[model samples]
Target chain A: MQTTDISAAQQAMADESVKRLAMICWSNDLDKVWPTLILATTGAASGLEVDVFFTFWGLRVLQKNNKRFTGKNWMQKGESFVDRGGTDHLKLGKIHFAGMGTWMIRKLAKQYKVASPTELLEMALECGVRLHPCQMTMDLYGLSPEDFIDGLQPTLGAASFIDMAAKADITLFI
Target chain B: MAYPQDAAVQPPALRIDALGKKCPLPIIMLAQRIGEVPIGNVIEVLADDPATKTDVPAWCGLKSHEFVGAGELAPAPGWAFRIRRSY
Candidate 1:
């Protein structure tokens, strides 16, 4: 009975029904987030089931961002408010030079005909890639449902993401 | 390997111009438009980005489509890939 069960389990593992990609987005910097979206879009384009969980600083990418403060409390507001930027206004991880490198990178991407991070994020949505916001992070940052762009999968916790990732053919953290 | 015939044998039903698009955009365009053509028909993708060489074929294999062939653009830079809709 044990040998039979082992063979059956191996068969089930071999016969995967879904080519899924689960990615963890842990940083909000443009350079980091850009590749994450690019991979998400590419996986979707290739017909994989793609999920991206935005957590920690990465939640900034999903926020309805502007110059105004965003948190409910003083510490949250003071720390995360001015740093909040959506896909269009992300800061570079290195050589930012007070936004000059960010500007240059955007221009360079345009000149090379490479899609901007914003465009890639939109493409990820258009391709039906499932976007999941981290619930704990949302609470910590005092964000609400309306803060994100439309067409997202419901919020997921780290445990929920791990459950999904266990069944995925590929998992990435970016 | 000898290519089945030439461009005459497998004329494309549609031509997607992704001349300036980079990386995954070309593949995204191909994926979005592959359904537009009938099964067994060919779609020619014109891409200037060097990555197209591997991406087009990889996408074809990943999606179970048929990669017909590729050719240089001659006076223009880059290459064109002919893909047939297998399913």
Candidate 2:
């Protein structure tokens, strides 16, 4: 009867459910950020529905990347001037050595033909990795949508991230 | 009949040359290009990075593609893997 077609469609739906990966990027350090993008990109490429929630200092990676420093006031400017938001400006979490370690890592990544963080992020976006910026972090930093790179989902709260992660097969906080 | 692999097989419809590249890079290239070929058609992936051996097949398994096999396809300093797209 008519039930057959409906059941067939349901079977098709059940057979095609995609795996999900939920990642919370909590640090801005280049070392940590590398793994985040690597996993996100790999998961997406492997047909996983991938979501990256950028929170706290990690939200800085979503900013409009460039060499110039940013800030509107004394404290903000001081912090940004000291540590920038772009991928190249991000220092290693340990053994930063006042930028020497940063340069060496970038250099090694290039020599090895490993894509830079910016390139990997772009690739992740290309492969359909959803990028969500934490609303609380954005507001705390006084950042607006204009401050970020293109292709970011509208800012959402931690509860929303929790809802996503609840359904995710793999959840990582980095 | 089981034939010797890579024995006068038809050239793959798509060839992803990822030589001199690093880990996920080669696999990413494979993912991006695998769609260019029709289902059942093979794709040739040339990669020097050691990680390619595992990553490509792992991706193939996850995506339901078929991993044919790998061998030396020279000037690349690495092996060439033949992958058949299943869907």
* lDDT agreement with native, every candidate: 0.87, 0.85
lDDT (C-alpha) at residue A146 in model 1: 75
Q: TM-score for every candidate vs. truth?
A: 0.91, 0.91
Native-interface RMSD of candidate 1: 0.7
Model 2 misplacement above 4 A: A1-8, A11-16, A67-72, B1-8, B74-76
Pairs that collide, model 2: none
- Candidate 1 residue lDDT tens string, A1-174: 999999998988855754999999989999899999988999999989999999999988887645356678998888666687588778999999998999998999999999988788888999999999999998988877877777888998999999999989999997
Q: Which candidate is the best by lDDT?
A: 1
Restricting to chain A, the TM-score for each candidate equals 0.87, 0.90
lDDT of 1 by residue, B1-87 (tens): 223585548678999999999998999999999999999899999999999999999999888898888888878897889999998
Candidate 1: the clashing residue pairs are: none
Which 10 consecutive positions of candidate 2 chain A have the poorest summed lDDT? Answer: A66-75
